[model samples]
Target chain A: MTFRAERRGTFRAERRGTFRAERRGAFRAEVRDQIAKWRRDGVFEPRSDSWLTGYDEDFSRRLGARGWIGLTWRGRGFADRFVLTEELLRAGAPVAAHWIADRQIGPAIARLGSAALKQALLPGIEAGDVRFCLGMSEPDAGSDLASVRTRAVRTDGGWLLDGQKVWSSHAHRATHAYVLARTSTGEHKHRGLTEFVLDMSAPGVTARQIPDMRGPGHFCEVFFDGAFVPDSAVLGSVGDGWGQVTGQLAFERGGPERVLSTYPLLALTLAAAGPADAGRVGELVARLTALRRLGKQVAARMDAGEAPIGAAATLKMLGNRFEVDVIEVARSVPGVPRAAIDDAVLAAPGFSLRGGTTEVLGVVIAREAMGAVG
Target chain B: MSMPDVEEAAVKVLGGAADMRDAARITAEQGWHLLGVPEPEGAGGTLADLTGVVRAVSAAGLSSPLPELHAPVVLSVRGQLIAPWGPAWENVNLAGEPYDIGDAPSSGAVLTRWRILHAARLVGGCQGAAARTAAYAATRVQFGRPIARFQAVSALVAEAHAQAVLAAAGLEAALADPEDDLVAVAALATASRAGTAVARVAHQVHGAIGVTQEMGLERLTRRLWAWRDLPGEAELEPLLGLLGEERAWDLGAGDE
Candidate 1:
């Protein structure tokens, strides 16, 4: 199976006037060769979602070395990032180590971080030498970010962070933790929150893995007993964390990652299914293709400097549903054993729960859509 | 022009109602039918452009004489058959039903574009119904408070909006490139199903008023059921049948 280079400006002649996808160039050849080499070396198994929880530091660093990590900050648009990410996911590469950094943290730093923070972070991030985990959801906060109780009190030199963060994926393995904590009291719960880029090895900070349905959990519970983060570590302005986090959510939620979690299994099912299962498999591919196209459209809008906040949430919600639906449908495939797809089936529920639960996304999208009509 | 621009223009031209005679008139008066006339027909736009116009017309719940209007114009403009016309469209519905059947052209490009337009219309109709349901729930008082204040009604509205949004995204995806048969099929399937669901929710929210013609909800809801059948399950199966035979499922086909 030969991987074809993406054509430039081929589909959608209607997009002539606005927000054209970045034209394909030499990077196509580069990414194609890299993927081919990885396939030959058997670096990772194809058609597996094991990479979601898998931690291969060297593999991530290899991707960084090949300059595949931070396509966004290196003058490449989201279209380029989409191409690279789709290829990685399709190959089932172990990307969890760099996933957070490459996807959200890196972009967040590049956009909102201070110059000092950016300089210290971007290089390590791009090199895949520094791994980062998101520190958002707290014990009391899951969908409601405005009520986070984690406090980042201003200290003599910097800020003293004290509180607990839950559902932090890969915190135990990450080198740094990007956290949002309350900074000052205000009339609104969303106010007074600030984003912090913390050194995970710092004193007074503790991280413990949380057991989950899937064994060897990637989620972690992080506690801070006055962990000192320098003022330089603060990302964006103090009170502007809400905006920063919202933007980060846009980056985090609206990608191929949301929808393609179970795609490996879906592809596997199609490859191995009998003639009786053809109709179901065909419907699955058709629906998945539509959702993937939707993701690409979101990427194009983001490239054009539009947040498309509502559209992003809508895509993520649909994507979450699609991921779970694919896994459930695969259960009926004739040749594939029910146990064979259990890993993906187990992971299916988390697709929506992790990045803003289905209910939260639904509210966000409905509000935005109704507000637009108003 | 962009689809939004086409949508805006179509809304201004066709308003929110559907009529066969109006479609026939608009096809002749505004040169809407000439949008995708063959290259030899002298000064015709791309199928992508025509697809946008068709999407706009469909979204606004207006009947359109597109590929049907193409035949006479193509013969007059190009002096030859650009594409063969398919069987005439015949469907049953109270909302926007076309009583007079015209020669519906069946060119692959036109068929794909029409299906995309049909999907976009379904999305638009679904969105209209969803908006009405949300508005009704917000205002309709029960137990001394708006029904929308209740989780039951709110959740229904949210689901309706989500369905419409899903269909809209699919339609946008298909509109991006109307040429891909698979994408068109997917778009049609997603939008049609969404449209049907949205129609049901709209009625559920509106109660008996939605069934009465005075509420005018059926104008959008009934059309969704009728138009959904054009590229319905039967039509999608053959295309999907081909997809089922494939060894590898490669959905990463878009240029972007």
Candidate 2:
């Protein structure tokens, strides 16, 4: 028998048990069905880089209505969520509307928020009724998060937030912003900082778009001048913001998203590739498969209630580098136009820059390793 | 026994097996090679079970004849490599090299299966080296602090660990369908790549000490370089030719 025929038989013969196999099959079907529907309606372009250009609130709601959002919070493990994400990313679906909120914000709130706050916000988040934007990075404090100058001062009713938050992704469109502010000064920079769920529609809050390298200004500069937030808006403990943000980074950095961001280009390259491109293409696929497995393992770790920052950092760094590698390899395949692969290649720089810069992640991993030893 | 049980048991039995002589004694006394054979003839164990044993023995830096001894029988019967045994040298191989046929001609199938096992074992070696190197880096002090405190060292160690994970995962996926030569080829290719990259980084991390014969890393690294081309490109040609051009990239679909 031919090698392909043998492999086809092997694939069919394998059974991964009832619960997992059925769940994975059903999830892939649901995603495929959604993709087909969107294609029919002219809503999603399978060819374009959906992550960069496809931020549809309606699409996010559509997925939410299908109960795809808040997967971890609903007792579906990270592995299950990973399956959902891999299919979405492979299809290049527009998932940016609820990506951050679904990936991290909801989990942070569920873990740290008050019972009343949970009652008020959790359902909306899960249903995609509300979207969230991160308010961590500032004009001067991109990777140096502890240096954020956004100050929250005490008031009779609550606290007043005064300062600017730059690179706040989609803040202009989001309903709420998870703002980290200095509550008080201390000997160390991390102490006395606080996290607040600021209402974007509040009287003193404003957001202006910051055009990135790509055309869309999906990134925004959020401004708050005495925006009054009630005490109930505190997402976690008053002075535990540093720990909270760090915890959220574990969720943000470790996922299929980090590794498979450029997968759409890979898929396109495969469709157009020739015999000559097989070796390089095969190499990329092997690395991607391995990283995907590691990503799932990390997801399982997160599901077990352990926030392994160093492991997550390692995955992000490796995955981000792989993303760039895929772009370079795809560009090399003969007869494929630079124009076809340009968007993904152009968006590639942010892969390493956004979550945490490669240099910063190296330090984080180093510190974690040293700490483990000591 | 189940795959996890096999893994745990092998870890227990081989954790201190250490060298080749020790491994041979344990294998002979325990009939461990029978675990790779099928029902009635020997103990019935899954391919995953056999893979677990390979991983443990490799990680412990011990050598086993189980793959060489059992794979020939399985491959020969299937008419894969050299045809089923002839009378001249039915059981014993006279060639100095472990892979070459003795006085009797054997199919390349035995060599192919042997290389697959070698790839899996190399992955095991990497798992061991990555752990040992990480520990060494974390404790070895330089400039009054652990060298792991430096990005240069930590990144190399982490990168090696990542490669090890990839190799293991790729192997496990290939073993999931042991019958597919295509999967085996891909798995072996990835293993070869990872083993080379990991050995370089490991040596770089350990500096002078890693190269010493006493460190025992050479036991695996030497075999890795030697066995990398056991089947080589010639043996892979039939499978690769059948895989064609575009279907090559789709090999990873099995992994998912």
Candidate 3:
């Protein structure tokens, strides 16, 4: 009887596995079909770094309507989300509107937010009715995020935030800002930090556009004179922001976005490639193949409930190089549009800078390597 | 035994060998070369089982002719078969490793096997070089501190390690589907590129002493250089070109 039950259980598990795989495949096909229809209808145009530069609320709403956002929180696995995100990135779809919230913040809020916070934000986040922009980097704190000077002092209902955040992408349009502030002095700079979710329309809050070399970009400088964030808006715990934010780095760094920023250009280059360009194209494809595998591994690890920070950093560091190299290869291909090449070239500089600079990523990765050796 | 067990066994057998000949004799004694060969005529195992031994041998910086031995016939890129016992010309590669040249029948199957093994060697070489470089950077102090504390040196260490990872990923993909010619081609191409990049960063981080035999960094770097261009990146380009955009994307997605 025991052996029979065990065999039956194994059969059921296998069936469940098959069912899950079929569902994932169907979901992927549906997304691809929708993207194709959108392309045909001129709903969106493919572009490089669309996750950052391309912000189309309608497109985001469409995805949200299809139940693609906050996938993990909705009981979907990271592998399913991996397929969705990879397809979206491959198409270079305008995913910026809900990118930040959907990618990391929504999950963070679900895991650590107050019940009141979840009631207020999770629904809108799922529906793409709300957008979140990061307020981690201050004028003085780029790589050294622990040294952020943004201060949040206790107030009547919550905390009063006052500080300046630079390079807050899409802050002007975002409905909310995920801010990190110094709450108190501690033994180390890494301590006394706290994370808060603040409403963008709060009193004494302002966002100014910062034009980059790529012309008017999504980059913005956000200032909080005395913006109020309710206690319920605090993410995780007070003075635990350092650990919480660092924990999200793997999610931020390990995604199809890091590797496929210039995939649209690569497709174009491949279409235009000649015999002379075969070697270059092959080299790029080989690297892409390897990177995609690494990205998949990262997703699987996340699914297994492991925060693969070092692997993610490694993927980003090498992936950033591949993203730039694709632009160069695109330049050499004959029929690729000059404008697309220009856009990719301009965007190439930021590939290694955002999230964590390549230098910082190197430090993380080197430490991980040394740790392995020891 | 499992793959890791096979690998551990190979390491134990090959770890303290004096030279290439000694390693080869011990590996033969252990029947490593016959690992994947079906039984009755030879010991029974699978291609996956041979991976660990191949990786272990190459990672140890010994040129034991294991890859060539595993194949039914060894052929050069020019379609010349490698003679088992002797060479037409006495030659050594850039790493001072033996380069066989002779006249025999060439086989595509043998060439593919050799390419996969060589790619695995390159991946192992990159890992070995990167690990040694990281260890050196962490210990070699400059200006009152370890150079690893410097972002410049750390970047080199990271690059080396990342390339090793990328190469390993490629090798894993190829091994997952060895029959797929495009996957094999891409794996070799990726490993070749990574081998060179890792060697470059490994040397840059190691400095002048790295080139010296005493430092021993050259052992892996030299093999990387020798193995990387054995078939060369250019040779695999045409095969990769055969992968159309959709097929190429599918190759990367690795969706079964």
lDDT of 1: 0.72
lDDT of each: 0.72, 0.71, 0.83
Expressed as tens digits, the lDDT of each residue in B1-256 for candidate 2 is 3445555555567556654446555665555555545555555454555666787777766556556555653232223343122223333222112332333444556554555576677788777767677778888899999887777998887767766767886776565445655666767766777777777888898889888989876665665554444443334423442343235434534423
Q: Score the docking of each candidate (DockQ).
A: 0.24, 0.20, 0.29
Q: List TM-scores for all candidates, in order.
A: 0.87, 0.84, 0.91
User: What is residue A251's positional error in candidate 2, in angstroms?
Assistant: 1.3
Predicted chain A of model 3: TM-score relative to the true chain A? 0.94
Which candidate leads in lDDT?
Answer: 3
Ranked by lDDT from best down, the candidates are 3, 1, 2
Q: Write candidate 2's Cα lDDT for A1-374 as tens digits.
A: 11121212222222343225456657666766777787789777654445545688888888888898999889887877887887788777888888888888888888888787788788888788788998989897768989978999999879999999988888889999989999988649988899998889998999999877876568899999999998888988998889888877888898888888888788777666676666676666656656776676688788888887877887898889888887898888876567658878777777898889988887776566445434
Model 2 misplacement above 4 A: A1-19, A47-49, A363-374, B1-29, B36-40, B73-97, B101-116, B175-182, B227-256
Flag regions of model 3 displaced more than 4 Å. Answer: A1-27, B15-29, B33-46, B73-90, B102-110, B252-255
DockQ of 1: 0.24
Please list the residue runs of candidate 1 whose C-alpha ends up more than 4 Å from where it truly belongs after superposition: A1-14, A17-22, A25-33, A47-51, A337-339, B1-22, B38-43, B67-110, B134-147, B234-238, B241-254
Best by the DockQ measure: 3
